[model samples]
Target: MVEGETIDTASLDGYVPFDSERQQAYIDAGYWRNITFHDVVDRHAEEIPDYTALVGPHRELTYAELAANSRRIAAYFVGELGLRPNERVVLQLPNCTEFLEAFVACSRVGVIPVMVLPRHRSAEANHVVDLTDARAYVVDYGRYSSGFDFVGLADDVRSSHESLEHLIAVTDGETSSVDGCDAFAEMRDERWVDKYGDEVSKTDVDPSKPGVMLLSGGTTGLPKAIPRTHNEYVFQWERMADAADVRDDWVAFPGVPIGHNASLNCIVGAALWAGATVAVEPELKPDALMAFIERVGGNYTLPMPTQILDILEHPDLDQYDLSSLEVLVSGGQKVPPRVVEEAVDRWNVGFCNIFGMAEGPLICTRPGDDVKVQANTVGRPIAPEADEIRIVETDRETEVPPGEAGELAVRGPGYFTGYFRNEKENTENFSDDGWFFTEDVLARRDDGNLEVYGRIKDTIIRGGENIYAPGIEDELVEHSKIANAALIGMPDDRLGERPAAFVELTDDATELPLKDVSSFLEERGIAVFKRPEYLEILESLPRTEVGKIEKQALKDRIVDAESK
Candidate 1:
């Protein structure tokens, strides 16, 4: 028997629930429904079978094909592999159709899919496996440009983890099984689908249970497991789709990691919820993205700030026809207002700034907003009536004056209640009253909009003056020759710490001297003390696995340069 086949739903523990009052109020407001991923797939397949659901570089899958493939894979997991309900399966594939198939398959059989990025090595992979006690890992056999052997990495993880029992390989080659590992192709084969299809179809699952585990981009240590139920996760996507004004005719291009919250839930999930097609790209190369967008009639996309900058500076940008793009959602960091303005004027596209996290409470600029608001602010909460946002003191208890800078704390129907199995973090990060501390410093504008200044830890104190990195970065990127900018505090013997800047230039031959930078800022009325004391030009900014500028890496480079 399968794990969830005979087990009681109430007996499944380890998931934290929202307060009864808040949950009830959300339900009363019709913000949440008893819906699951399986339900969404089934509904779309039955209602619009010929509609394209997923488009990758290799193939395009219709809604009917997606539903059938998911059921077949679920059958293999339950009947052939004997995966129990609630057992964790680590999915470490790139932006491909297989990732979606695996996600739906896990949902169909009541198994929890722990999404891991393709870039995760043994260190991160082992930690996730040990954290989730994952029963199986689905990896690819060097199908991407990185050329890393995912099969070998899966084997290494299996060796170190006691709970790991299966290694399913997705290969580009014709051969299915390698050694004793099962082939992903075999799971979708007609024979296996015919054999176990009915049995897997008989499996029942609860809609309110934990549906997936997303890794949090924690500032301090290894990523934490953020478990979101089917209803809450779907609510987020539906709300996002409405805000972005996405329609069934839209084609969304997701260039970022499909495992990240913004790309997974907001971009791809939102598109799918609207019955739109998702054009998946493995990487964020400017040329490839522009071509793909032109080729697929891509009407919507959400690219990070760095990616936007690259595309804006691409030499061949004019060669591609991007007129089909309707909207471009840029976030994951401070989006330069200049980029937003230029993208609108240059490409004739609508732009929305999205401020969100894996923990939840997505604040996005709507399509109807003024261009200035779309360029400057991250907009209001998705569901203003149901979501609560407060600018509070650093202690996280006292509310600050309106339009004043303070810590941002939020609570909503879509947000997660707590991190999995981590009581210390929960106690430290979440309030007893249920608000989750975002650790970001924000201020409410007089117009009732929110402006993110920077993170609490992102401040640079030079002598006694506080310098906000985003403030400087936002100004620096306006320079005609500067493509991207990041500010970090470098150690200084005189002032305890002074600000340093790492910049990617639009023209490699052009140099930005310290004097020129000082002159530029002084003309802009920037405070003298807040000016960066050191500047370094680089080919590109170092980015984290999730594509945010890695400030620590920049700091390390500064330290290494000083040491040398």
Candidate 2:
């Protein structure tokens, strides 16, 4: 869940705060709990209003119909799209129930959404609507069983952004209008929820501003905006739903990308701030997510070790009835400890291990850790006293010694108060006394957990989709038969990595297949899971005597041609 892009408004002077003695030491260590995510869906819709909060693939909402469908889509985004409060739309919907009623109706009307990924088209949705000047783009009305067309890619990103000016969509039946957009079934019409469903009162809301922007799977271009505020995502989804014990009669499921950031701060913002029950299922198919967890008794999930090796190699893996799961976790990359010891030796299911980042550092592995330290550590710091974690050494202040590996960094009330309007990636990824670094690498172990030693930036990650490699090697040397490009990441026991480009040609080029580099990165709109699944033609790439590119000598020539 390493996505990227950024921008914003609702004035906290457009943010990058955290300095009043690091925001009152994260509000005196109560981890800044000033509330607001529509005050946890209006205090669980007045305390568990008939529980079952959201199931999707058709229906089942309660928590008073997910807080009255997020206050009737926050009164159709401020009384029929006049949208204000800090306006900045762009959602790009998909794990439907209108993507959690337009992400909790853009946090009950202080609109800031900007998520971007139903496999983003139109050059990463017109570079996140030219970095969040977004005044509505929404989507989800037709084609995407790879027929592509998300409402004709949000009308070609609203005819190449005219400050976008509303487009909406999200429908399944006759709410009519499809091309001129605006029809999330007319905001659940009860005559527009009786004229703006009490327009989202409680003094508009501030929970220390920002409330959702996240994108940043960045290492080079097109992805850089990780805002995340509402009191730092309610202290990172209620301390990662109390470090994955997540109960309010848990059900979860979040098979990733319900606007990611590890499915919103680890499983639908910790199952809607722990009132639990999320479910959703539009695609991440392991026999349709084990038939939507044997038809919805889900019992928690997270899946991303190549979807736990495609649901432990589904050859109809014992024809469903996953014994109501009860915890699985896994995250972006680095996770094979036998897929956490064969999904906890089959069915007693506990699994675990997370490690996040949009611009924050979530790190998990809890629910009673040891299955070999939840298959080789990742645990610890689900706010270990409001995050500090260092390790260091390529001099981001030196430290690195105790069983060393380096790079991780951190520093936070769930880290992020930078990179919104770039300022050169907020000064090359923050650290003049603020930290964030995370070019990964890790290693901590003497029982304090950590481990995963890899990345000092030049990401790839594949099936859990990070894919940076110089933004597809700057669109593979702008292709005219390429003259230099590199990409990388090959080993894929089911997508734990895939890309592999390499290039070099152009001098009356010769050959370059992998379907002409996946139809020239799908006509340059890119994201068909960031294209390039193998295409090595290089007569020159391995550089570094100062020229750089020797990507570990092209990953030791795909590990010496897969050991012959």
Candidate 3:
């Protein structure tokens, strides 16, 4: 059951954060009747037609105008391109206005969209596109990074995929172009805005049809394509938005890659679901983000943990007047205690924790949570606690005791139905009782709050004993000399496996070798048995496209290095 069942029938413009009871009261009403992900923007298009819904570095589209552009793109899709309902389209691009335009257009047309990270190698996108049998694709063909020719890669994908019929190139304010691709400019030239605007109506939408496909991190093995019905994610956004104080008057800054589930589902999607505005472009540069925040009197920012650390450590941190910020959320990684400490004690803002994932419900700190509580635990369960949120022991999916680590499984209105076209995956992920297995391991803290304990698939089994990486990681962060650490199990002949520590240090800190780091941990309460055997410190850790430390990548590297 999709959880977002009419939380409020009141005007969205006046909508503000509501407590659990009021939230349920609103839910008891029909605020969400006949609504889906597409419905959010459609309602906004009618309610606040003239308001700015999207702002990019190059273009700004009002709600009505966005709808107009989306209609045109949708028409191009349905009429010219002949994209069918529930058919898949691949959108791979950096944070750009055109990506949003095309994505929204797909939603309006009832086409399922699969967002591939723009940083994907041509080979990766090729594999995904082939697997999905994508009907069309959106790319930033002329983009250049690391001096690689994006156009060349795009061309290769178009040639390689048999079902890939259309390639729409979204440009970045430059005239230079890629040949053999349909440019975004062509749509305007073809009067696509006038031709497609409102051309397709929502006559056939079921609200239960699959709308988006999110690929898992493939941490344990191959990436699985998780398909979500429109209503499932819509319910997630509506409830989470109401809980997180998302509203029309609020301005949110999401610096993470929009392609990630955390950013799209919880942060930006929730914001838009409530008629709130996100910053024009996702501000990556701290200075630019600060400027945008100052410009809009922005109240909310939910940066990745490392990003927040960078912001806190910036030499010019004192120069920015961020008085506009009312709340800060840290997730996708653990927030350094010192960073969390300063964010609240010094900044005097609501520093909160957001624990979330693609296949599960989200938990975020409410407005009234104290700084200490917010810093200590990720959060309590989100309400309309109609959903089943439980931490189960290893062998079976039954509830666990406090302070005991177990895998998390949730059954709720916001949970996904199944993975796309993968019955085998569905069989493994869902239980006979109807709960979706999130596969994320977590622990209930002493205070009855939950702290995510890392992926169950990433767990280390050494000599028949299981080790959770996050436990060691949190302890590693507590070390005064350490900046950030990731523990990955390396193969050991006798023990079967052992742990390794990969540390990324502060800019100016002297290099601490493995021996010294081990000594520091031993001097603390960490037992010798738990200490990492091999510690490697390099310049920086490699991150996924969305800024998450790609442990798989790191593990692969470690394996390669050891073998060499």
Best by TM-score: 1
TM-scores of all predicted structures = 0.94, 0.32, 0.88
Task: List CA RMSD, all candidates.
Answer: 2.3, 23.1, 6.6
lDDT against the true structure, per candidate, is 0.84, 0.75, 0.71
Ranking by TM-score: 1, 3, 2
Model 1 lDDT, residue 504, Cα: 87
Candidate 3 structure quality by residue, lDDT tens digits, 314-427? 888888888878778778766555677778776778766877777656777665687676876777766545556878876655689988888888765567656655677778
Off by over 4 Å in 3: 1-32, 142-148, 172-178, 188-199, 218-222, 282-288, 513-515
**Candidate 2 vs 3: which has more lDDT:** 2
Q: By the TM-score metric, which is better: model 1 or model 2?
A: 1
Q: How far off is residue 238 in model 2, in Å?
A: 22
Q: For residues 1-564, what per-residue lDDT tens digits would candidate 2 score against the true structure?
A: 011212234353445777778878778867887877877877988988998888877778888877777777787677777776666888877676777777777887677787887765788788877877888887777522434667787777778778888887766665466758788767766565577665555335566778778787532357777778788888888888888878988789778667778777788888889898887887766788888889888888887765666577667889788898888887665565656877888887776687787777888788676798887777888878768888887777887876677688888877887877777767876868888787777768777888765576666788786766654675676677876677778888887888788878876888878887788789878888888878889778765211235576787889899999
True-vs-predicted CA distance for residue 104, candidate 3, Å = 1.9
Tell me how far the alpha carbon of residue 40 in candidate 2 is from the true structure, in angstroms, after superposition.
22
Q: By TM-score, is 1 or 3 better?
A: 1
